[model samples]
Target: MEFTRPLPAYLVTRYHGWKATTYAENHAWYRRLADEGQRPRAMVISCCDSRVHVTSIFGADQGEFFIHRNIANLVPTYEPDGNHHGTSAALEYAVTALKVAHVIVLGHSNCGGVQGCLDMCQGRAPELEETSSFVGRWMDILKPGFEAVKDDPDMPRALEHEAVRVSLRNLMTFPFVKEAVEKGTLSLHGLWTDIGEGGLMHIDRRSGQFTVV
Candidate 1:
């Protein structure tokens, strides 16, 4: 493999700007973080969508949240089959190593991954049905979510919310996460954001409804 491509000029310029301004102003904080290591109180699992800025949504500073991003923000069930599990790896580290008190799954409207899952479930996305498609396989984790919302008039929005629910349920499958929750050391949260309106909805676990926040 060849590595010839360099960082984009715009990104390089942005990095220099941040390093000079934000980094300079917070020099001591950055150094302390580097020396003491991160001890974020919460772990946010969010979508890979660029518009869904987790830190910005909460107005959090650097080193405040341990975030993991993936398509549809899906979390597969605990499978210790020894295969590569990026999401699972992050969950393990956050729960066991970092001992984060809160685990938040943040979903958003107009999510491409959710749309892809919708299409695949409806038999419209034949490509995603192929085993060779990594994204297709990953989105398969949300098939049940699709089923739960397939009959709804607002399928897209419903599925997006269901995705958060699915991930929350799957998070409990991990033994460590379950233990922490049972011991009252950890909590799980599900949130859905409306991208265009910038409104947020919080899931009520007992009622299984997403109410405005």
Candidate 2:
């Protein structure tokens, strides 16, 4: 009986030492936080991309953040039109149920979904029905950003940043989000990260600069 296992070595090693690696002497803290209950001050909306984990990147331990991820990290405006609305539902819970103080959208470079929209714009990817299955449907959220940045030299990065900006705006469409902000209970933030440059940028509303901090 011959079988194949070509998984990455690090994954294998980590799994072999799961408990020790995951807790890493933080068992007490994890237990205490678990007992005290989740009082996470923020809910993060980020891409489902593997590299963009908010908890690991920020060194956030258990009970530190309420996180959500989706394709391209889009938060469509509230609608009663019978869509799945998974992201919207999660937003409602994090803001209204959890009463999070800050809602942050985390966008990043080299996003495949963003690049796909760019491909559609440049006429590389066809708009045929059922092509690339759900990808075409999912990337529709970035259509406006594609139109906005397709002419720029920095089209790629700019569109990614635009995604973050748009998501922040969409967050307000939820009544709870709006009320929280109106009453000074909630704030919106945007962030962009670069894997190539090893840089992180936070949004400045006045300047619209994603300055690294």
Candidate 3:
């Protein structure tokens, strides 16, 4: 196969800047991570949106978080059918291998993927109903979330928060995760971030509401 596109000049310049600034300042820490291997304390599942900066939000450092990003940050039910499962694979590695103490499902405001699921559920996106659409199939995992919030006055925002709840429920479906939770070795948390105002909302397991944090 022949490649056509060249690297963007702006990205190349930014890489050089990082190498000289952040990389230089953290050189020893970077080398230690490379030699000692990563043992992140927490696993964070979040959206693939470029605007959702997980590190900046948590003020995390290198080797601090085991992160996984997917459409709507949704976790599907455990199928174990010997097929391609990215999210499940990450979860397994985080729990069984890395032994992350906490797993957080981070949803955000104005998520395009959640909006797509909402549109599909509302009969607006007919193409998403087809079998060939990858995104449509992936977003299907959030269908139950949309159903729960379909009648809400603010359907979009409600669905965004619901995605975190759905993911938290799905995390319990995995045997390893369930065992860890039961044994008090691991814990699950749900969070939603407002994009515009930068306010954080945490899901209260007791009240089932996304309360401001």
Sort all candidates by lDDT, best to worst: 1, 3, 2
Per-model lDDT: 0.96, 0.83, 0.95
lDDT of 3 by residue, 1-213 (tens): 477787799999999999999999999999999999999999999999999999999999999999999999999998899999999999999999999999999999999999999999999998999999999999999998888888999979999998999999999999999999999999999999998999899988799999999
- The residue-level lDDT of candidate 1 at 142 comes to 97
lDDT of 2 by residue, 1-213 (tens): 258668899997887796676676677888888788788889999999998878867898778789999877788877868878888888988988889999889888899878877787677888622556587876777787777767778878888888887788777888888999999989999998886776889998689878886
Which residue pairs collide in model 1, if any? none
| Native-to-model Cα distance after best TM-score fit, residue 39 in candidate 3, in Å | 1.0
Clashes (N, CA, C under 3 Å) per candidate: 0, 0, 0
Residue 69 alpha-carbon offset, candidate 3, angstroms: 0.3
lDDT of model number 1: 0.96
